[model samples]
Target: MKTQSKKAMMIGTLALMLGTALAACGSNGNNGSSADNGAANIQSANGAKGADGAAGPNGGTAAGTDATASPDLSKHVKLTWAALGDPPKDFDAVKARLNEMTNKDLNADVDFVWIGWGDLDSKYPLMLMSGQNVDMIYTAGWLDYSGNAKKGAFTELTKDMLDRYAPNAEQKLPPEAWSNATVDGKIIAVPRNFLEYQDAGLAARGDIMEKAGLTTLSNLDDVETYLAAAKEADPKVVPFNTGASVGDYPLTSFVTRKKALVSVPGLPANMLQFDPLETKPQLTSSFDDPDLLAAYPKIRDMFLKGYINKNVLNNKTPSRDAFKAGQSALAAYGDNQFRDAYNDINAAHPDWRVSFQSFSPEGPFIKLAYDSGMMAIPSASENKERALLFMDKFFSDPNYYMLMIYGIEGKHWAYTADKSQIEVPAGSDPSLYPKWQYPWGFGDWVGFNKPSTTDYPDYAKHVEYMRSAAKDNPYANFKPNIDSIKNEIAALNNVFLKYGGALAYGAVDPDDALKKAAAELKAAGYDKVKAGIQKQLDAFTPGS
Candidate 1:
């Protein structure tokens, strides 16, 4: 039996202090379909689902879970991986292919365990506490990955282990990604390295924009312009689509400093100087802060004016569909979602011209914090080395990786003549599409599809635009020892859940919301959380 890791312990302690309160407040599955786990699904609502694996690549070469000097990796071992979102449609079929690889190379096999979206946060922790022999876990810093790492829920994979077993994974990821995975200078989890260009923008209905006498959607201010344009052009349509409680999952991917008001409540209490590198810092309430106070009426203004969907508060529409079917004229989401939405629209309405705008023209338009792509090894696994090895293959094995993420050839996805753009088969149910959760793929170095995107000149143009607007995050390495402010985070977030949307959409009275938000922040121990974080930052020098 493998012993509990320090990371798990810390996570447990913090969760004990924090998670319960959060659960009480509403971490309720914000998923539209009682099944959506807040995980960002960038692909269209239902383009082509990612295909299943056919006797795939990488694992067939290794044999066994031997961390010994001689490394006897030939023994067939069963390892378990747990994650919250849906897997590829070909998960079972792909599992067999991966098993075949393990049989060939490492002489090992894997057991796939899935946790439904609703049960993930609560159930995953209980499973870990029960001492289940899980080998690897998928984690994003924002999604409790680093918190669990700090709690000793995962083992540190030393350079020695990487050199010995998973060299491909080590080599494929860039230093930036690997560096982010380090806690106390030890690598505890794997950053799913998929290519990413951080840019938060808005997706506009090309047809609507044309009808509205508009050339393009560019800024937050332009939101009203587009809304008016869409409204004047068509009488029975909502100009924009937004949800009251929806977490900005996809938008966070492109923006630079997306601290959640719920995820990190203190956005209103006092201005906590957040570090760009260390994304795991426990945020304090900004509810009382002047800047945050300003955001309240801003959001309310939009809500009152009908710039957004009237039913936004109770909206359950799959984001892109609302825009595609002409229910809404725009979607203020992430660049990836925007791009993928464009693809979906093209597949369905091949005749329409579509495009989106970057985070507003007036700064504060975006910030990218923790990525959607993150995975961690479990502290309870007996075959961690082997688990990491398989993961390394998953990361480095492009053939298998693409097949797992994008789907099969000529069936679910078809390549353009130049093999640049991929198109999903017509009328494929969006639900059938795989969730791509085997391991979250962030825009890491591992997935550069030069051939896959050759024909999509627009995608290239978008990448360039994103590149120009993208800012290198400065605090990617800062991990707030939230051990001290654990309880306060949940409380603060509860208060935030009450006010976050009012400000974002100009729905609530700014002064009144600030009063309630500030009062609650103090009650929730905002000062203590800030001081804890500040002291840590003050004492440490960056890169020391």
Candidate 2:
């Protein structure tokens, strides 16, 4: 496990302590239909049903669960989930309606502590370190779930606990989900059953692309062309709303697509890369790679030409948020970021015609880590059992899960006539109640809904491609035991952050910066950290 500096720990602890009370207050409400009429009503109400005539993601039953089936729900409780993203308008009303069902069925009311994308890194560590009263928080491979689990920040969920408290999940979730959640022979989190492409791409305004006479962004060159045209078309908007702090560098996709390298999960900036197709791929550093060096000049050229924000290093706004707010012409990030950006931007400005262009549109897409998005109980949580029960309902109960993601149906969202997808309700401003995109922990392929079909058919197509084409990650189960080299890793990470962003964003001379960074990293024990990771990798099996 990694250790924090004395100064960082002190500051993080203080920040979390100060925000503990308000964190629980960041809550949203959702409404649920009664079990007796839910399935029938869903089926009869304008043909609003699932992919099949049935109601759930799978053709199981209707949206509601029988409240009386649970003999354990004798006392009412409240759960606080530390989730990502800002709550939409009417969140309070939605929360009230959602609590109505939870109160009836699980005898619990849930609150979400909204953590913005910009604040996630700093705040998440603080919450865990401070032992905040949050019952559950989002966890993933990118968020260092295994590292934190080893550090004793998360509760060790036993098989018996899962079978008893979250029976539906234990029974319905695939074996891979459980195995993915396991670290050091213990289940540390409840893994999301959904699979997605773990690749980066660009989200741009199709309307602007049309103005530029460009229809597609197939490669980095196309991205540059689009960025130039976008700026020319609208000088008021920044071409690319990217920053260095949150790893929002524009060249991320370029490196990934050009090299066809698979990123090592849980690493800083995914700096470690390897060829998955190689039977015994060796770990390599982006800093030392020739491809990264080659891309730096192109990125620097874009930066020098005023394509990116001049003060990006100090900017903390998330790239997607900047795009949605109309402050930037394009947002560059991952598949999930594209989905959220498309949903919100399309809702806010249907005329703008938002679209996503995958950096790797051909082959080499990798399967997302099964635990890429999950809900983990914090070690400090007082309501571990109740939290597990909530997970059970969120994953199993369609009505509850829908509420968590889409809010109250009529008020927040509406289903299509065919009942295969969702759409904005008539006369409702989608921007006001953008689909609740932050319930990632509850995202099960068996219960989730695809929204906004009218304005963005590409999103649906991309979803299909991800499910069908993405290959499983060869090192999905290889969680490196960094305990021995945690100090070296930390030092190397600091070296990268201090110099990597400058090189990536074109704020410094590539030649000078690269040499300086390489020297600093080597001095900081980069080789030792790499060896530590490789040692663990060599001893692990891919699908064992």
Candidate 3:
């Protein structure tokens, strides 16, 4: 695919600026003094100096040396890694510290490029099309990892290459993780080892639940009872605050064994639902599904009965903000969001405790593929070997990993009294020096240490619960080739954008909305896409 001229011009300008910065900082120098000396200093401090005078973590070889010596590509090469979100105010200081360790240990410098979430969809394609100088990039299934891999936007990381350059990553990550990262038998990216369960559920204000005499939220009926009690406690407070953009399908579909049909992210209007127990999976519409249709009217009745916010269809404010302000009693969220939501709500209302209950607490937990968050090498990289070395070090070395995730130890955060947990300093202003960390893109969850500030104290236990309970998606490995129906997918997506949210929110009559959506989908050639998907599914051999 050819790049747009405008994007090419922008990339050229960025490359020029980066080149100038590298030259001014003298980061390209080949002298091995800093790296060699730093390694020696660490060895002396740890008293791990070997008989050959080489120093390293395990006392095997010097910092950069191993059983297989790393290639001498340390000519001060600066690699750029792109990730989503804005850089912190003190990003430069953090980058400098990162360079200090990397330059010394791996003879490399890395520049992080932060792309705002809104701009990523547009920017990523441009960067790939232009063959931008970025060596490493953060990608995910949500970001169209499969599409990009198929389009040759990322380098295919062979097993031998990984063994040579990133052996730590290969060995530490689970075999299932590698399988998730593989596309057409080629590993296109390194999956971040952090595990998270994304089952959808409700978070309610504990104070409200207690005042209402509600003990636990086990099922939809229990949730309704809690919401009703919350309404009785505070007549002004909305029992449940929902928005047009947020889907209530998950909240209602919890009891059903059949999954709700929804558009796949990045692929847009192509929709599918699978029965986990079914040997031969088939795509079907939620609108036509009896269970989904039955659930919608009940939610709509709740909205009409003042149990849900009156302005839910038009409310633009996020549910978290509404809950924090005491405007809402309960909000729908994923299992992973509970801890963060609890912390945020408590920060605003210290007296108000927040509790989350998973809608799907039993077996059949949906296991997300490791490619949910990953770091991929761009095919345009000039320093692939050096990039791999840096990644290996980032995951293997605890000190380097910590620095990369959290900023300078004493500055951004400090250890608790016993040095068992991380915390902010007593008098430091957190606003001035924001702690910016991207755990998803960084490999090696084994190296990750959670800060004590997280509201869920039993996070490890929760992870274990999910591990033993959750079941993998039967069609996780299936990747449908949508090249033939691209235009139809786009058209169907446009139709969905116009009608899907309204149906999800129960903002319109279910029968009317469903008929309209179904008709439009058919007019947009949904059958062709369905046929295409079916063909791929038929050809797929389970566990092949």
Tens-place lDDT per residue, model 2, 1-544, is 0022222222121111111101110111111111111121011112123445432123333235442254476778888988764777778877888888878878888887876544555777889979889998887765667778888989988755665577666655565666778889988888766554444556778888898778888756777788898888888878987542232544544554544454455564355767665678788765777766777788788888888887666566646668878888876544444544465667688887887666665556556555766789999998898888878777666787777667789876788898866777878666565554556654444445554554345544555554455566767777766677878877776665566556656666788878887888889998888887877777777666
Ranking by lDDT: 2, 3, 1
| Stronger candidate by lDDT (1 vs 2) | 2
For model 3, how does the per-residue alpha-carbon lDDT over 122-213 read when each residue is reduced to its tens digit? 57667876888888887665456787787788898765567568767765666556677887778888875644334445667778778767
Write candidate 1's Cα lDDT for 449-501 as tens digits.
32233122264455544444444544545565776677786676555545543
Q: Relative to the unseen true structure, what is the C-alpha lDDT of residue 305 in candidate 2, on a scale of 0 to 100?
A: 84
Q: Count the backbone clashes (under 3 Å) in each candidate.
A: 79, 7, 0
lDDT value for candidate 3? 0.56
Residue 203 of model 1: what lDDT? 62
Q: In candidate 2, residue 22 scores what lDDT?
A: 10
lDDT of 1 at 398: 57
Task: Compare candidates 1 and 3 on TM-score and give the better one.
Answer: 3
Query: By lDDT, is 1 or 3 better?
Result: 3
Per-residue error (Å), model 1, residue 198? 1.2
Please identify model 1 stretches exceeding 4 Å from their true place.
1-79, 83-134, 172-177, 192-196, 229-238, 243-292, 305-317, 324-326, 350-352, 361-372, 410-444, 454-457, 468-471, 505-508
**Which candidate would rank higher by lDDT, 2 or 3?**
2
Candidate 3 regions with alpha-carbon error over 4 angstroms: 1-80, 85-96, 106-135, 159-164, 194-196, 211-213, 218-266, 302-317, 325-328, 331-333, 340-344, 378-386, 404-408, 411-437, 450-461, 472-474
Q: Give the alpha-carbon lDDT of every model.
A: 0.48, 0.62, 0.56
